[model samples]
Target: MADNEFQSFLTELRRGSLTLAVLGCLQESYYGYGLLQAMREKLIDIEANTLYPLLRRLESQGLLLSQWDTSESRPRKYYEISEKGRLVYKELLAEWRKMQSSIDSICGEGEEDERFN
Candidate 1:
């Protein structure tokens, strides 16, 4: 594939995993920037532009709980995974494992170039 096609493929691949990664990150309470930093530390690159809207959507969907923390000079919105989020995460994780196993079977673990064959 050309560079542009490869980049597109990578973006699409990461898009599917981003929600799960964000959900897992919120297992403990964290503010927006903090969560971004944590993901970066874990080598999961999540852009702030993408993450903020996702947080709002997840909260609206009842999968996340958030509150304004004003203890410090600046008030920050902190988020955590709701009980529903935890349950959903568990189900997603199981499904991900099954999907990964299927992929590995087809790809033979490493050389993904011949996977479609």
Candidate 2:
């Protein structure tokens, strides 16, 4: 693929995972940058600007809860998944497993593809 096309494809890939990553990461409380770091540690590869805005939006939607904490000298907002968010996460996880099983049945080779995407 051309550079621009590859970048666009990558953007598209990230688009689908943003919500899943948010739900998955917020199993523990995290500030925006901490969430970015946690997602990166899990190989989600997201940016802070993108994640912070998403956290705010999800909080507003009641899927997440946030609080401002000043224990570290500078105040930062920490986010955690709400009860509704956990329910959504469980549903999404079930759907994801079903999809993965369907896809796995269609592929006869390459274990890494099954492991990664």
Give the clash count for model 2: 0
Give candidate 2 regions above 4 Å deviation. Answer: 109-117
lDDT of each: 0.91, 0.86
Clashes of 1: 0
Local accuracy of candidate 1 as per-residue lDDT tens digits, 23-72 = 98998999999999999999998889989999999999999999999999
lDDT of 1: 0.91
Assess the local accuracy of residue 28 in candidate 1 as a C-alpha lDDT between 0 and 100: 94
| Top lDDT prediction, candidate number | 1
* RMSD of each predicted structure: 3.3, 2.9
Give, for candidate 1, the lowest lDDT window spanning 10 residues.
Answer: 107-116
Q: What is the lDDT of residue 110 in candidate 2?
A: 82
Lowest lDDT block of 10, candidate 2:
104-113
